[model samples]
Target: MKQHIYPLRTKKLKGSIILPYFQGINGDRMVVPFIFWALFPLVLLTGCGGNDQKPEAQQGPPPKVKVAYPLRREVSEWDEFTGRIEAVDSVEVRARVSGYLEKINFVAGQKVKKGDLLFLIDPKPFQAQLNLTQAELERTQTKRELAKNDLARAEGLLKAKAISGEEYDSRNKGYREAVAAVRAAEASVYAARLNLQYCEILAPIDGRVGRELITQGNLVNGGGEATLLTTIVSTDPLYVYVDADERSILRYKRQHGPSLEGVEAQLEVADEEGFPHHGRIDYIAPSADPETGTVKLRGVFANADELLSPGFFARMRIRASEPYNALLLPDRALATDQAQRFVWVLNQEDKAEYRRITPGAHVGNLRVIKEGLTGQDRVVIEGLQKIRPGVKVSPEQITVGGEQ
Candidate 1:
């Protein structure tokens, strides 16, 4: 029997070399033509010179990144806490005397000083009562004078033994009662005058007044529960209340002496960048809260611009350590390596090297580097991920807080 040879298929290789052969059983193996070997070198050259092929990109100078020398400055470390801005003096304006709301003396949301008139209640009723009390007091005084004259006459009669002692004693009792009545009437007159004065509601403290709750022409009840007319909150000087841990409280007290008052504190609102508002702690709690193990502290800040309002979310910082010269880097330059904090620094060869850092309290965007860096180290501030243990980098130098 003849050993049959069959070409399975043909493939066009390179430019024009068509080859057809594939492995088969020993008995069916077929020999390839020598023409394939002769043209293989030419095919290789044609494929290499094809127009569709692209050249490899030349390795550009290592990735460009922003770098900065550690900022060296005299700095004070601070402990940060969050709290709310509050008014030092907050008052719920209420009517003290019950009457018709006759007039509103000041516009809503206006700043009012102590004793500034804010509202007015009808004074007609109070004036009438004052008049009645005055009249009653005059009548009582007249009665006391008449009683005195009667008692004097009775005394003479009693001495002469012209009448019983009972009548003389009765006259004496009447004089004393008249005097008591006058005193009661006078008290009533004084109260009536006070009620009339209350007709003009005045601000008890300097503050910004809120909108009136009960407008003019409304009857305000000042009896059992006074009517809430509006609210007022002191604006110039404000308070920020924060709860500090026992450890922090102790640390602050130890550093600034036992008395924490007058120790400088700084505050910033949620939208602010740094602690721009400056103040001092005015009050410290004598006892710690049993549940939280924290003490409440009150910071007093002058809000002359009235930009800081009560109930605003704020961050408060109190000095924790004295000022000292320290090395600092922008917070963006710091990164974590498993359990340790580290930053990439470019060496003399412009290659990044891992530098482990022991960080201290954060001072705004910059963090205090307690360890692992010198003033000469150029830290990688931007393009952190592109940096490797020893990767070369093209660096652009910038200040710690300068824009990247």
Candidate 2:
């Protein structure tokens, strides 16, 4: 029997020793593959350090949007319109009987009562004509007296048979002709009197007078060409003309019937500070203005205080339809793409969701919500550009001022 043992050999000359036994086992041939396999897991683990470097998840809600609760309010429904103020009765005072203007009796821009003296024409020529007519009437009266005396004498002689019937008849005819001449002369005197009175021009209406067209000593003719002396505009009652769209008027008519008598309107002048006066709808045009598709509506206002004047620019608030409660949104909350309007609404879990809205009339800076939104929903007004769909949001309650 023989005992066999593997011997471990070590040779160290300077610093290290190489064992030739591993070479005998083909160890060097396995060096490159073994190094790769040893470092492979470390490289993969270092490059794929995913959990440690994961990005921080976005916190809580995306943003806080301002919101409000829409409540029903009793507002007097009104429609605004641009209009013009006019006088109920306006007339141009023109010179009818012409002569040298003797005096301008009324001041310009003064309120005058009816029959107030406005202007005076020279009456010297008219006075002379009146005196001539009077003299002619007197002469004709004297002739008629003499003719009547002769007719009486003829009638007495014919009854005594000293004069023929033909003579009495001739005297009667003479007296009749003389009497007719006197009547004609009297009529001439009346005509002369009227001509003299016509020299004075009077205000035909109670109104305010405009600028004077003729000054003193301006030669004017009786029955001359129509010359503008001044303009008179009645101020007790004023008229306003307003235009309304045809569709709106028709809708109102369909709901409220044809008449607008009881409808009250508030009127204000353009430069005035407040609505100084109110009026009622007096007229609505039977047809619409073809070009504008609007109907002309007129209102009458009592202007006894003389606050309103003719040709003034006016603004009117008219009751065009019935009042109803509606959802309202701030104009800034609205977003538009192409022609479609939209807004971002908050969900129950505080997420941004887009809502398409149907917009109605504009109530001042606010817009009337017609459809596509419930009054309870929260609408995003500020920070809208920073939000998108499915983003979480936090709603901050806000108080809306004014109409919106």
Candidate 3:
């Protein structure tokens, strides 16, 4: 058998090669050459199928981001608590003498000074009693003068021996009885005078007065079962009462001094913004309440403008720690992952890296970094969402107070 080799001609179709069947010179079919010709195109196609030279991968420009070094400054931590406004001096004005309420001397809600008249009970009855006592005193005085004259005569008679010793003793006893009567009358007059004075109720303290509880012309029961006439509370230099938990109290003792004498405090009311009133801790309960596990604290503030009032719902913050150097970052730089908090830190290679940090109270617009960061660390402040861990970044340096 003679082996015949067919010359394979390749035609390129687009990017592929194609082969056509060729007839043999003899009437017999040439299977071997046809097979070779069919496979020739495949061989050529396989050889030229893949380019050894691959196009370089297109790299994107590094994401632009704003970053800054952590701020290093002295920071003080504050502990906040719910509190209430209280007056330094509060009084419930009541009538001391029973009579008809003749006048409400002070307007409701008006500021009054000490010794200012607040109410007036009808003085007619008290005045009449005083007059009666005074008249009795005058009569007692006449009797006392007569008794003294009689005692003088009795003493002279005893000295001259003209009257019996028993008679002189009797006359001296009568004079002593008249003197006792006069003393009793004088005491009654004093009491009557005091009752008349009490009819005019005077303010015991300087404060703003509440509405009159007993109006004019109403029968008022005084001294024995005194009727409440009004209430007054000091307007300036108010007191604020707050309850602090055991943990916070202990922390305060550890950070600040044991004594709360000068510990500074700031307060804000429900309708107010940031704490505008400043004060100092003036009192601390000697013992903690077992039921509530808290200690009572009192602060004094100057409310000269009368903006604060007693019984106001207030939010108070006490300085618990002294100012110390701390690392701080903008609040925007912080990120939360499940239960953990982290920030994107720019490494030496200018790549974003994840760093878990412990956060603390906010100081202005920045948050104190309690842990996991240092003053030298540069953290991404803006464009946090645009990058991820280990991604290259073009960090634009910014000042610490730029956004603050």
| TM, every model | 0.82, 0.71, 0.78
Residues 1-404 of candidate 1 have per-residue lDDT tens digits of: 97845646566789998777654555454557779768989999888987876688988779999998999999998888999999989999888899999999888899999999999999999999999999999999999999999999999999999989999999999999999999999999999999999999999999999998987999998967999999999998999999999999999888877769899999999788778999999999999999999999999999999999999989999998889999998887899989999999999999999999999888877899999999999999999989888889999988887764
All models, RMSD in angstroms:
5.9, 12.5, 9.7
Please report how far candidate 2 places residue 83 from its true position, in Å: 3.1
List residue ranges in candidate 2 displaced over 4 A: 1-64, 75-77, 138-183, 255-259, 272-276, 286-294, 304-307, 402-404
- lDDT per residue for candidate 2 within 77-194, as digits (tens), equals 5687889999888988876766788999877898898899998889899899999999999999999999999999998899899988898899999999999999999999999998
Predictions in order: lDDT: 0.91, 0.80, 0.88
Q: Considering every candidate listed, which one attains the maximal TM-score?
A: 1
Model 2 score (lDDT): 0.80
Tens-digit lDDT string for candidate 3 (191-282)? 99999999989999999999988668999887678888889999889998999999999888886667788789999998886788899998
Q: What TM-score does candidate 2 get on C-alpha atoms?
A: 0.71
Model 3: worst 10 consecutive residues (lDDT sum): 23-32
